[model samples]
Target: MDSFDEAVDSVREAIDRGDNVAVVSDPYGGRDAVADEAEEYTLGVERISFSSVAEADGYEMSFGGQVCVVEGCRYLYTRRVDGFAPVKSFLQTVVESDATFVTTWNSYAWSYAAQATEVDDIFDDVRVPSLSSAEIAELLSSDYDISEFLTDYEEVTADESPSLRERLPFERLRFGIEEASDNVFEKISGMSRGNPGVARAVFESRSWQTDDEPLDLSYDDAFALYVVVSKERVSRDVLRRVVSPDSLETSLRKLSDSGVVGFDGDEVVLRPQQFADAVSYLERRRLVW
Candidate 1:
């Protein structure tokens, strides 16, 4: 399962145990899936749109057992500054109510909303920002062997349009690195990570390597490499390939249960680091003591 799937599943499981939850996100990003999964998993769900939040106060008061799942929302609409007042008001209902909350968004908007809301202590906020280079370096320090994670990296493809990178944050370089790491493992035995695009361009350069070594790189690998070399985030597919491998699915699921890497659908993402001293913790996990 990707990061989205995992989050949905976790909330569903929580609801089954009779806990109410608030799953929030944009409309396009799969609100229905949560409803379906909640029903399928027997977790009673109630979906609330932000536009309906003012009306929801009574609903929450009246509904006793169902899990209140809110989706298709932004903390505030991007076009209007006036949007914040409604959002804050709606969030206040959630804060005052006895409900668990979950929200999703694109990294940029999420960060902005998070800053505007400043209600970190009130809600158990979970931030699933696209990975960055610093995170990859941090993961390497952990005892987490990435052989499994590498495969999910293969399923995702990079956008051919370079303009995407310009729109996304530089911190998202982790997705590119994870994708590239997969490519390096599958193709070039001694791939260099010095420059992001170097390894990928090597294959695309249309030169000596393909003619001499005849490396059998698939489109999946190509996409992985492209993101890596370009220093871009891996799209959804690649992240799916890494954590949801056929053989290791069960183990990965268990790891997910232990909250190591989170899943939204099939994409795998790391949790926010809890410890202040990540570098040392990573080193210990790597057994580099």
Candidate 2:
């Protein structure tokens, strides 16, 4: 059987015995590896890939503020969900719900979690196991066994993936508070410094709070941010400052479709954390500018 199938069988046995499990693994054998296994081994699946913090929070609320227990949900795989804030919030929500959440990513993702005490506690109920490239090589070797591999290796030694770290050029585009247009961007930045969820809400709400305008984020605005922050795909000058919403909805819909933002019909919500995650993945792959 494939590794994913084996994982599903293992998870099924756990569920049959009325057990809750949280599986964490390395870059190679990630949550999806286990998720594929679960789908083959069991029935019923309710899965959502959050791309922004707003969407992540919405997911949390959908399950209720109190813990949301995902019963018989064959699998839950969170890929590259970054930023200290959104990750922490999502983890806490799942932990409080007492649900089984299987997540996977490179080393840096976990390191950031370990540093966030409150965020780290969210996974207190989940078991996180990592497999580095060296370990993967050992697993592929004829002399290696999963048990022996775990015992022989210490923590992973490979470098954490940068895409899983900061979401954008913010790492390279650090601006002084004085450089901020007004104090609001700075404040919003401060609130979401380590948390994408807060930053997303702040960015989207800027229009509503600053001016008496409605919370209408146009496609032009999104394209602007996409090109400006991403600094990859489209040129910065290509973004013209036009206060039009004609194309905004279509663009937001595309983002939401790709799991970058949250869309409930016309309203567009940016899960700063999840958006950061999606952006991280895209940026890592050089899909965006």
Candidate 3:
């Protein structure tokens, strides 16, 4: 797959032409790549995130403080819009600052906003694409396979099909990864859902290692993590209704400590990079509707 550079380039081109741009990407897909490009263009990048529109009510001061720190700093946000207020705040931010303002959104969330509000009027929008299988293979072939890590080849994928590491779109993306106790790369390719970030998470979960040197992650933990990340943000109460109490705290703690998820008081969210992984996991479990 192509690097998400084209979407990043479009935003850069818009800003150069003095037009603000809005980008919609999958949770683990393209937003940060755009942010990274923006950072390269200015003194600093003011990256902000909001779990919901209500949190955006008074973003002026937040945006202002950053502008003051670095004049003409690139301003970027990834706010999940549940109402019109965030769109209003986005306009308000651009209106208040003649400086360029760019916003990123989750693809599913953006589609919902398009129908519910007049967000279409505010900025030019683009939806980023998922990574290609070639890209996934390239990533997997790097610094993986402990057995291979110690061999002459740091990482090697079979030149053959169904050779887990070398395969792409390897299996049905919906069946949550296969058990770590049995197959590893099959699970990685399946659950990752053609998304780079999710594949990276599966790689880091260390599920590929054999029993002699194990990092055990249970199906419950995987599914619980999935519930928290199926959307941008989920309330603790909602999680309580879904996740078993006996398992909730443990799952939350493991995900948090592993940098896969985070807590905002009573709310739980998938950490930025971990979002794709959670999606892959949930899809595999058929827990997503």
Which number leads on lDDT? 3
Q: Candidate 2 vs candidate 3: which has greater lDDT? A: 3
Candidate 1 lDDT over residue span 147-230, tens digit each: 553543332223323234324454224333333443433222122121212222332342213323222333343222222111
RMSD of 1: 18.4
Off by over 4 Å in 1: 2-6, 13-36, 50-65, 75-81, 99-104, 127-171, 174-289
Order of the predicted models by TM-score, top scorer first: 3, 1, 2
Q: Count the clashes in each prediction.
A: 32, 24, 5
lDDT of 2 by residue, 192-221 (tens): 332223344444454214422122334354
| Residue 241 accuracy (lDDT) in model 1 | 41
Best of the candidates, TM-score: 3
Residue pairs with backbone atoms closer than 3 Å in model 3 (clashes): 1-132, 174-284, 175-284, 176-284, 176-285
**Per-residue lDDT for 200 in model 3?**
78
What lDDT does each candidate get?
0.37, 0.37, 0.54
RMSD of each: 18.4, 17.3, 7.9
Q: How do all models score by TM-score? A: 0.37, 0.32, 0.57
